[model samples]
Target: MTVENASAPPSTRRPSAERAAALAIQHLLSRQDAQGWWKGDLECNVTSDAEDLLLRQFLDIQDKKTTHAAARYIRGQQREDATWATFHGGPGELSTTIEAYVALRLAGDAPDDPHMAGAAAWIRAHGGIAASRVFTRIWLALFGWWKWDDLPELPPEVIFLPKWFPLDIYHFACWARQIIVPLTIVSAKRPVRPAPFSLNELHTDPRLPNPSRRLAPVNSWDGFFQRLDKALHAYHKVAPRRLRKAAMSRAALWIIERLESDGCWGGIQPQATYSLIALRVLGYQLEHPVMRAGLASLDTFAVWREDGARMIEIAQSPVWDTSLAVCALADAGVNPDHPALVKATDWMLGKQILRRGDWAVRRPGLDPGGWAFEFHNNNNPDLDDTAEVILALRRVQHPDPVRVSAAIRRGVRWSLGMQSGNGAWGAFDVDNNSSLPGKLPFCDFAEVTDPPSADVTAHVVEMLANEGRSADPRTQRGIEWLLTEQEPSGAWFGRWGVNHVYGTGAVVPALIAAGLPAAHPAIRRAVTWLRSVQNDDGGWGEDPRSYLDEDWVGRGTSTASQTAWALLALLAADERESEAVERGIGWITLAQREDGTWDEPHFTGTSFPGDMSLSYHLYRQVFPLMALGRYLRAVQQGQSVCGTSDLPR
Candidate 1:
């Protein structure tokens, strides 16, 4: 589909690189509002669309228009083998396949249809109803397709667990905690609605006692958890009714407390859906203010594609996108007092979360001045976003310098205080390094813990250095951590993006920004890695497979955004006059479309690495502009290709 882009300037007879860079910068500026903000589609996969339909079916509010639209979107994503994948050109994911099948069935697709039959065969061959993730099975259990007793037990009493206790609700990752708290209520209620048709045909060997394979090693953590699960199940039946009721009430209160923004609970669809479901089971009516608001909020996430509608985005990225846009513009030499920057700055300033959130557990007294990725994710002001926002604001000379400094100071203190004891930073929460939950029987998806990551640590360090804190002990330790994390091949593992390319791209610049010399072994290793990964097309790309396997690290079809990342990394590492950097710049100059933007259908940005991949549509435009701008500026100034001339040292 053709998308409108930022308007570029008149194409003059300048160098190809300069012309393309100017065009891209102009186009990006054109896309900004008078208020100085930018937002692009936060596209996920069909699972969201399918889940939306399932939620509608469970509520008995399935509308024909939305169903047909959503079904069309799901159908378009099914592979020839009757399965769906989490990312483009990736292997079929069993959970995605199961969810798509259920959504299609809910949309009135007959199980005997050719596509339906093929999917059924595939599902049964794999493991049928029981082989899916714990979350998937829970969804099926809601429709009477699976037995509640067969699912993992999430008692409402989980909310009562002390914060210090392992496996407590609070101890899980922030997103997981929000999901689990509401789930405890659902699991306790055990409410099952009648399905339009039985999924007997989808089960493997229906004659077997339990067609769903719930396998865990007999003598390990799984066994221990299994035994504990049995004990909990037994306790469920004999427990005092009053206590359970009180726990359910407590869970309901917790869910309602997080109903942020208009009607959203934590600005995520999954949590909102579960919150709605649990509240309904708790006897909230359809017209309840909370329910209506939640249902209305879901509409914001729906995008009507040419094929049909897709419930793709978990949440929007207004703050993240806006800050990145501002930084790119500033890098292009846009006036700091430009109305666009001023308006966007004011808008971003309003979004800083001042109230305490779950992060308060780790730093009980730290003031809240961090920004969330999404507009309404107030309780979870992430470290990455906070650092980026501070960097962006620092670029513009806002009229209210005092306010900006105050906000930046609070954000810095909050981000630094949130750092893990190992001298690195996670996107959200502190020292959230729990690996035990990932080993649970139902957690077949990728790591769910919010652990410290190279990309995040780099951002934090870069922010501190830009603010003239390069020699700060925390900043130095972060740089050291990054050095130790580098792979022997010179690439670092990307925790939030696709793979090594993203990791190296992030770490190199941050290291240089913190006054690490380019000749340093760590910096040279990373620079060597970036050069080695360059493709014949003069661009770079890392396959999504890199998230799952090491062999594919820094290997994939040449992509515009990945190329920009590699170029930026090289430039920051003093590779300005290098042929590799020039070739990369040439590739970017050649790839720019007539509209001044570049095409990147490939999923680049990631959520949970392997579990869920994302495409920040703006990446193709934003990074290239920043990279090209920095390159031209450095060349014209006759200086080294280091980032921002004001070196901290």
Candidate 2:
């Protein structure tokens, strides 16, 4: 919503990308924190605030200030129809609307309030609470608003399953695994807190309650899971008391072990909430250190302002943000030995995971040498962060090259070891794409498995080549995998960013950086794809809806970040001399704000492919700088820029 375009007609003399890039560089340097890192506001849906309020409600720690502030923020996001959309300017989301209404209710809004009525109307019109995701209904079941029997069956005994089993605890992507572990304990305990009021009005047909209990098709796998769930429910009632108690103890221990030093579980709200509630159900007191520390950790997620309104960040982005800032500064010609760069690199060096994590479950015996996406998520370092961090480190001439070299070598080795059999790299786990979760009746959202992705794999490939491993068999295998995965249209599927533009942006530069020449047909085809999708305004754009519908790929109004991705892709494919590149450069300079950052309200990061999205608030500022810096570097070097050399590698 903050983005701006020219109000007047095009000028004869536009600021060149190179000149504008210098202005942007100065703008970025002025915005750095005293601690030598950049942390932009990470904006997500109302669910975070809604969930926080619910967590507070469960803990009975409602404070007047936070409650009202979060309420005001939620109210501000309600649409004309009194519903909430997941991303800005998107259509209403049923689950988001239900949660927002519940949070507002917990904040003391009367049920008959106009906004509440409208939200209820929207919910009832869209198949009511039953139609929402399993996670949503599970939240409701806690407050006696929904029946526990109607929910999916998750036994605490899952924690005791052997790794050789199909649905072992490690089978899930780390985030989901964290959620499930604590949630299984919660499900087994089945604690119900009394609600102040019932939600009768939101139901579609009051006579037909407990929707989740309805039988699924007996012929389908979903139906079989339903039957299995029903059978488990029956066992829940008759299971031996001592065995169930032991299973709960095991689940609690599992959760406690993974809690971060700050007491946040996996550095995400959902896991922390589940951990807190599960422990409480198991008789942990509010005064217990785990409970106290967990409660204190949530305050970090709150973004309170002088306006007395607050928003919740789903998770922190320091590691990801700090690494990107390093690359941007390096590309803009900052001295690698600058105190800012030194401080950042030193901080990064300290964050590497030298100990094995859950990722090693599938990759047993692989040495631990990677970086997490957050400041404290040591239990789950990702391939993306590790690759990007190594790339950023390569750009900096650190005072201690021996240490930096050691980190790079370790990270590259660990990262390569985590690559899938297909030669692509996954984020947190290798070969994590077991299809059983998708077939479950409870899985209503997007893909949850951490499968190999083009964007992540490309970043790894670029990092590998930068480390002078281009001749290695592993590197060759990765290149062959990427070639096989290229789309028919010459674009690769972006499993992490928005869509084709981002995938193409990542792959082209990586292919080039890995020694594929611009003259290669693969590079030529990719360059053609980028040009063909260029917007009339001379930039590139892709909608978040592109994940929902492929038809929308590369077809939205241009934003600073997506345009930067397109421009970087073009520059990588040696298209700096093309008109498409010229116009894209023109668009970036034109969109630059007085503060030196470009406006981008649209989300470009993907969490679960099509379902969950995020807007990294600093992306507009950082990416344009990298794109322009790369363009300038390429023009100076005659053509082409390396993905891992600089420009947000």
Q: Write the per-residue lDDT of candidate 1 for residues 40-72, one digit (tens) a residue.
A: 888777888888998988888889999998898
| Model 2 agreement with the true structure over 248-325: per-residue lDDT tens digits | 998888888888898798788878888999999999999999899899999988888678889998888888888898
lDDT of 2 at 384: 92
Which ten-residue region of model 1 has the weakest summed lDDT?
1-10
Model 1 residue 75 CA deviation in Å: 1.7
Model 2 superposed RMSD (Cα): 2.4
TM-score of each: 0.95, 0.96
lDDT of 1 at 208: 62
Question: Which lDDT values do the candidates have, in the order given?
Answer: 0.83, 0.84
Q: Using TM-score, give the best candidate's number.
A: 2
User: Candidate 1's error at 22, in angstroms?
Assistant: 1.7
